[model samples]
Target: MPAIPTDAVRVADVAARIGGSVRGDAGRLVSGVASLASATISDLSYFSGNRRGIQPDKTSAGVVLCQSKHQDALPSGAVLILVPNPQSAFVDVLEWLFPRSEPTKCIDPCAHIHPTADLADDVTVGAHVVIGAGCRIASGVRIGPGCILGENISIGSDTELIARVTVMNHCEIGARCVIQPGAVIGSDGFGLINEQGRWRRVPQLGRVVIGDDVDIGANTTIDRGALDDTRIDNGAKLDNLIQVAHNVEIGAHSAIAGCAGLAGSSVVGKYCTLGGGVGLAGHLTLVDGVHITGMSMVTRSIRQPGVYSAGTPLDTNDNWHKNAARFKQLERIAHRVQALETGLNALRKNDEENL
Candidate 1:
């Protein structure tokens, strides 16, 4: 059985709800969503043309969401819903069918709240959560169980801090932001000064300022700045296990994938995308719309807007070793070539003189 409950919905009604146009029978009834390969006659499905082994003509789904290019490929028995973004429209259908249950606005009895902390009347604070002094929580805010909020921290309206999340002192989170489980915000920067044989720790005096509609993934650690604030602009999405070092300024609408690490003082421009395991060295900048491929290490600042990739491609172990050895002898081989060129030049001069 499917985990999601199936509902009898009309094709035209769903099209109106998702802002799409229907090409076939609008009166057709679809019960639920499924993939093209597994769709039944009563189900709805989407084809994005990128997935392998999924053909629109072979699908048995009654209602389908797809682009105009793939509409002709649909079987005559199926109903095609024309949309620019098929995946997004499918998600809208899912939301329309299965509405999320709203959390009750009530503070848990086991939670701890400081006397100076300010909370809205409709805020929800869960069990074992701690709200420190000078903290402000806006309306429609939900703090999940086992969360900790430090002093002078302000959470905007409708922001959700998921289970076991920690927000340290002087941090601000904007409205409609979702912080996933185990995320640590406003942690101290790794600033240390080497004095003789001893290392002196520098105080991290800044905060993390997160903008509205930002999504921080689980277990991601965003360190506070050494002096200024570490800022993540609106609509920025961070994947799980990402390390954002001190004073990193991530521009608006930038998406960073899992395990990506940004060192201190790095600035990423707006609409930039960083693939998984990408590393940005300290004090560098990336221009707008710059895309870095997975596992690439960026040491220099990027001034252009295009997809960039580094690191060697995969090869056999023996071939890689041979290539590495050859690369090491190039300088010596160039000197020998230079010596032969010099001797050849001397002989050519003597022949020309004799002529």
Candidate 2:
């Protein structure tokens, strides 16, 4: 982090930069960005919503990015960058302050590429990368060090495969896809059968089809299907350490967070959001617009569009033990209640007959 600046910037400069208005002191200098808790005299902080209780009042920040409605809550003499959306303005400032590195066009001599591999004019292949025969790498594609591409793989234009990415044979990755380090696509599906207690291997013959503008996070694995292709639709984002099993179909624009697992043959609908550590069972269907919270175990198909959650929060051992005990007796308690209901019905019938 850089030190906070002491030279104050004019409120008109910031307003022109992001097309917003200044609500307070234009002379206050915002030299650095910081949290509301640790902000110094030259630091700038922002409050997104009503979540920050007392931190905004006691902060020493020279400037704050806040909505127009919250202008009166700021400390006296503090500079305000009034905007309709404070977070969006903060993002613009962060991007301006910290720009990303541009890709350098360079190919190492140590990379092993087949003579028939078609690399575009501006492609960059890093050291020790193996591009197999019949591979077509498009323009602006960057293959990082130690990546392995199997034969006949077609990587679309402007796609980037980071270090040690493995794309197996016959897979098709669409344009502008970003595959992070250690991601394995088109791996063999888990298919086997026991013949008289002896296991028999079932070969996976399907391909992995990844659509355009997809981002596969580091160390995620998508298995090849047994007899059909496993498809990932356009604009889908997958987080690190996720597993997509054989023949699974993920619809367009769905976002799955880290450590989530989808079992074989499951069909997830469009625009669905899955939180971290969510597990979807095999052969089930998740309809469109389903939002599952973190650490949920999904065992059945969800047909409606709504938020769903399960799993108990962390608790003390004593309380957890009591809860577990009560949970185990629920079936017996239900059976006893059914028996009592039946007895009451019989008594009511006998009283009617006697009358």
Candidate 3:
């Protein structure tokens, strides 16, 4: 969907939004947001780094957002707005520049809406959307094109489901949630039982309960639990291509980056940050405020709040091979160290007795 574009606003007006003070030409026009290296004369950029080695002199931006410490690095003739936190102020400016618009109020003629479905009067359904029987869609909700909502599903007010979103049966999505394109909620969990040699599929009998202000990224899949519901708490943000397995509970305000996979029944506590490509083993519980670095493998439960990581540092292939070889001799080396310490202790005792 196209975002609502902002018309040109005075530099002073932009500065007022972030509580910043203008250094030059408060009347300059700012119509867009860009980086310092790519900003046009009508666009605003930010200097997010310290003044060290900064070259604002080469930037062609008409306006720059910076902290008060970096004000000395502003180029001549360039307008600078100094704020306490330049990065946050820059985000505020971006939101102002590219505000998201509500989808136009229209239920497309091609949509297949069930007669028993309960949709609010102001709800917008895009083309080819399928709302099953007994589904309830609340006011101000927008279901984009090709969305499929299964029977008995409940979508709350002001929530937006982008194109091709699939919410399977019995799921409940809370208000103000944003499910990005191609996301599949309430999908079957990867559960199986072995009968001799063949595997039998176990029934996934639970729903997915997503809380308010949650953001599910594109192509992410959240599986339905085997017995209890899969729960995502409020203010949690998941990045693209992540896998959240069945019975996994992500606590409030936790942020997970792209390509992270949470195994089945793993519980992540509140305010945790999972970096990209991090993998959590099944059934492990992570305490609150845990920060995991990228590409780390977490195999055990974390009982305290702290940064956790597993995996070796990157090294050259030859060095890696050498280290791998030495790793095999670790037990032998420990035995030698133990024997040396034992002999040294015995010799010291004997000398003391003789003295």
Which is the leading candidate under TM-score? 3
| Residue 8 displacement (Å), model 2 | 10
Clash count, one per candidate:
0, 1, 0
Q: Is candidate 1 or candidate 2 better by TM-score?
A: 1
Instruction: List pairs with backbone clashes in candidate 2.
Output: 5-31
TM-scores, all models, native as reference: 0.90, 0.88, 0.93
| TM-score rank order | 3, 1, 2
Tens digits of per-residue lDDT for model 3 on 1-355? 1122458898999999889999999999887777776777877889977566657777888889988787777677789999888889988987878777757888999999999999999999999999999999999999999999999999999999999999999999999999999999999999899999999999999999999999999999999999999999999999999999999999999999999999999999999999999999999999999999999999999999999888889999999999999999999999999999999999999999999
* Whole-model Cα lDDT of every candidate shown, in order: 0.94, 0.89, 0.92
lDDT of 2 by residue, 1-355 (tens): 4334335455566666777778766765566877767777777778776683555777777777888888777787678888888889878876665565657887889999999999998999999999999999888899999999999999999899989999999999999999999999999998889999998989999999999999999999999999999999999999999999999999999999999999999999999999999999999999999999999999999989999999998899999999999999999999999999999999999999999
Query: Model 1 — TM-score against the truth?
Result: 0.90
Give the TM-score (vs. native) of candidate 3: 0.93
Error of 3 at 195 (Å): 2.7
lDDT of 3: 0.92
